[model samples]
Target: MAWWMSSSRSEKGRFLFFVLPSLICWHIWKARNKAYYEGVQMRLGRICHDILIDMKGVVEVQFNQRLGVQTFLQLYEGTAHPPPCYSVQLVGWRVTEEGTLTLNTDGCSKGNPGVSGGGGILRDSLGLPLFVFSTYFGETSSLRAEVLALATRLRLCM
Candidate 1:
């Protein structure tokens, strides 16, 4: 019935501009109600879910083009547009000789908080593999593996 709603529904771009503000407002209102009535704070996960639900129709209409444009604009505004540049740089220069110390470590987890393994490879400066070691842990977190990797690397360095 309203003029904005009528134009919004008829024009694709207009519809997105009109609905976006309302969707944002609705999410805020719902979050307030959830906090006040249920005494539960909204988490990032829930907020993200609600935003996805609210934007579903608009996203379907625009097919991600407008969304991508919006993201690009945000980034552009946040940073001055810099000219694209490329450069070649050397890495791993220290690993040039056989006696040079080189360590590479990685961690793998079956699930986020499930079985985990941390492994590392030690090589001399010449890139010759000196040792490969792995450790398995039960009911561990990825963060734990990361910490263990750091600790193990330190021990090897010493």
Candidate 2:
């Protein structure tokens, strides 16, 4: 929250930074309720889109009359949308004993029960890749995806 506020200091920008948290939390809470009580699947993309729509409206109504429609729209677009950030980390891999093989795997889900996948790699004692596999489980929990990845590797070993 502090980082977001510090990124922009314009009057409208400050307003957006202030109300952004409330708008985000409200939509997320509503989505959670809808998913639990209504048995609807929650989609983050849809929730974010809805939040953006509300933010746009709030900016327009509060500033448009005085700032003019075009200026308000520009401010809304610039301040409401945060800049994209990307990061990378280098991980060191450990080698197995000379007589053994090692396997590493991972799983991920976009929205818990939405769009799941797993992948793994097997390496010889020398740390040379021996086998690799990737698969899409399609709409499953992260735990299930992880289990599936390990199971697939076990089956390959057998």
Candidate 3:
């Protein structure tokens, strides 16, 4: 059996096998470049040590995306990583002119072409609620429900 296979079992061993060759090739190239340019050569043990140290940087970057070094490898130990956070900004609705009303409309569907519904609200200049309505569209696309909401808004105004 190979030395790596003797150290670990199954997928971990396979993953290490895939990654080690690339690191080995990279370090070998670096050693070759130094020898060509500066007459310096790395011994076999030194080359292997350099490769291991370089791999540390790659692994650290991936773990940094999670939490810290202590908790990063916790997936194999059965501890779940926390979900990432995102920032969102929301603005309030604007008021209409004193003589006019603002109508806001929206629509929703269970699926692209499944059961759908539409809703609308009419507000005055001070943003106080004036009128509201919601209707079922049986089975239709969200776009159809949106169009129906707008049509209902226009009919209500007249």
Candidate 4:
């Protein structure tokens, strides 16, 4: 079985293992095309740096996740192990000023085009919850769930 198919792989690792290569390759391909078609040239090191930065953005937007034990970034940085995990203190949502409401929403899926759900909380100025909801969409992508969650909240608020 492929490493990605193994049951032993952490979800974060599996995700990155599959996605990072594809994304990096795609980025390289696009850059190659840009160089050939548009007469743009970037140093090899610069191209690598851009691919790495883009990879970080891809990981960040996915729930701010990180690989548990190992990561490509470790190899890129020439480190055998990633830095130790740090304790974080999370604070609840707050409105910038009084009389305002904040909507915090997120969506996730077991797999792309697999079981998905959207969730959110409506909070008052002081972070008091006014309403909260989460609903599963039988078979869908996380992106669809994100849009659905915002749509649902819009209808509910009006």
Clash counts for the predictions, in order: 4, 0, 0, 0
- Model 1: per-residue lDDT, tens digit, 91-154? 6535465455778888767888888878898887777788988887667789888788778777
If scored against the real structure, what TM-score would every candidate get? 0.37, 0.48, 0.44, 0.44
Give the better candidate number (1 or 2) by lDDT: 2
- lDDT per residue, candidate 2, 1-158, as tens digits? 44364665666778887888999999999999999999999998889878877877887788773333334345555665445667999987676678798889998889988899999998888888998999999999999999988888889889
Off by over 4 Å in 3: 1-89
Highest lDDT model number:
2
- Expressed as tens digits, the lDDT of each residue in 1-158 for candidate 4 is 24435454444455566676787787788888989999889467766777667666666677475533243455233322234578999985545698889888888778988898888888888888999998887788878888888887888789
Task: Quantify all predictions' global Cα lDDT against the true fold.
Answer: 0.65, 0.80, 0.69, 0.70
Model 2: lDDT equals 0.80
Highest TM-score scorer: 2
Candidate order by lDDT, decreasing, is 2, 4, 3, 1
Ranking of predictions according to TM-score: 2, 3, 4, 1
In angstroms, the error of model 2 at 35 is 50
- Mark the regions of model 4 whose C-alpha exceeds 4 Å error after superposition: 1-92
Report the poorest 10 consecutive residues by lDDT, candidate 1: 72-81
lDDT score, candidate 2, position 17 = 77
Of 2 and 3, the candidate ahead on TM-score is: 2
Q: Cα RMSD (Å) per model?
A: 14.7, 16.0, 14.9, 18.4
